[model samples]
Target: MLDQQAVDAEEERLRELATALPDLQRQQYFQQLKRELRDPDTYAALNWCFLAGLHHFYLGQWQRGLFNLLVFMAGLALLFSPWPWWGLLFIVLISVAELWALFRSQIIIQHWNNQIMRRLLQEYSSAE
Candidate 1:
């Protein structure tokens, strides 16, 4: 159907993004991470490997990273408080969201790389 075609197109785009130069720049973003230590794919996987917000932070998405972190902290607080059942439910929700983020990491990284590439390309072209 139409959705299948869209998926295929997105896959093609991701393949193109993988070889793009902005992927290198994305890797060099965080000084603490070390330029050679983290690539786009690895950064994306870190979302699940470390925390649900880690990837977003790597990508310079402050709002998303903060939101996820805050939600997790609140959930942990609730877990030890009187609302144990609510905390469990929140934890379950976070787990599901994390799983989704883990599975979609490749696509997410590709999308972010594409954006970076576009901006870099535009800047390079404008300078010329």
Candidate 2:
């Protein structure tokens, strides 16, 4: 639910500002960013394959991941009951809801990385 152009422009602006830093400072920025950056492909794969919000965990979104997992487990519990359709429907609904992330994973992870970069930059600047 983000504007692609705006997010991309912000990332570009951040990159430019980073490049203007002295060599050592810029190196530190990149090193930290590299360690923090999450891979879109991996997130996408987890979302697509699991459809259970494991992808959120990969990006350090623990609450969302746990919520999804709990719901999925509840659905599974319902699945074993006499009314099997309820569980099936619950699972399908959650899967459908989460499916959007599969398509927009690249942008999602890019935004997350940008946030990390922005925070690191702010920390470096404020430390001075």
Candidate 3:
């Protein structure tokens, strides 16, 4: 439900916090941030292409990705087995969730990036 405006506001707030750091630390901080930041376009692509929750893995949500992968594999197995109905149900459920992620990929990615920034800043502060 987040618009680009909200993402921009959060980024601006993070930038303000960065002002407290020394120039050298700020440079290093931004370098690290750039390395760790996630991309919305990539997330959306993964969601659309795989639909097996690989997008979650891309964002470091390994547990959810594994769950989705397992569910997808199980669904495939069931789809060919005698009880295809169960497989169909599982596939439908997972697909619905993945579709939701695809639609909200921008918001999800921006929020994740913001969280990453906050953590990096906290870690940097504690080190000082």
Candidate 4:
């Protein structure tokens, strides 16, 4: 568990980091976020890839994506095999992999969205 002092210190550090960015870069960041949020189709497409474990490609994490894809394929193959035990194991593994990918993707997307929102809020506060 995190102590209150530690949490407060982290918040202060985050505020400092936000203040460090120049206005133009911060505006660009906010614009990018607004564009992403306004385009539902685009956002859906990107998020779909994340759910499929293919978003890593966009982030240049190809190796991890390939590994996950291969694992999923192997699980599918095993699931179709004649041996019941092997099939069950493969199904279980595949389910676990899918869940893990889903959770990771959600976290990544949430983090990105939060950053965008933070930038927008900061911009608005500064303007005011």
lDDT by residue for model 4 (1-128), tens: 22445544544665565566678755665566556533323434553554434555554568976775666566667767776577567556655665644444544454445555566657655754
Q: What order do candidates take by lDDT, descending?
A: 3, 2, 1, 4
Residue-by-residue lDDT tens digits, candidate 1, 1-128 = 12445555765764454345354443443232233232657775676675647777887779988887777777878999999778777767776787776777666665554455445444433543
Give me the displacement of residue 70 in model 3, in angstroms. 0.6
Q: For residues 11-116, write the lDDT of model 3, one tens digit per residue.
A: 7898799889888888889999999999999999999999888998998899999999999989989999999999999999999978988988888898889999
Each model's lDDT comes to 0.61, 0.88, 0.91, 0.55
**lDDT for model 2, on a 0 to 1 scale?**
0.88
For model 3 the TM-score comes to 0.90
What's the distance in Å from true for residue 11, model 4?
8.8
- Model 2 ranges with Cα > 4 A deviation: none
Whose TM-score is greatest here? 2
**TM, every model:** 0.66, 0.95, 0.90, 0.46
Candidates 2 and 3 compared by TM-score, better number: 2
Which is better, 3 or 4, measured by lDDT? 3
What is the lDDT, from 0 to 100, of the residue 127 in candidate 3?
73
Q: What is the lDDT of residue 45 in candidate 3?
A: 98
Model 1 deviation from native, Cα RMSD in Å: 6.5
lDDT of 2 by residue, 24-84 (tens): 8888889988898899999999998888889988988899999998888878989999988
Give per-candidate clash totals. Answer: 0, 0, 0, 0
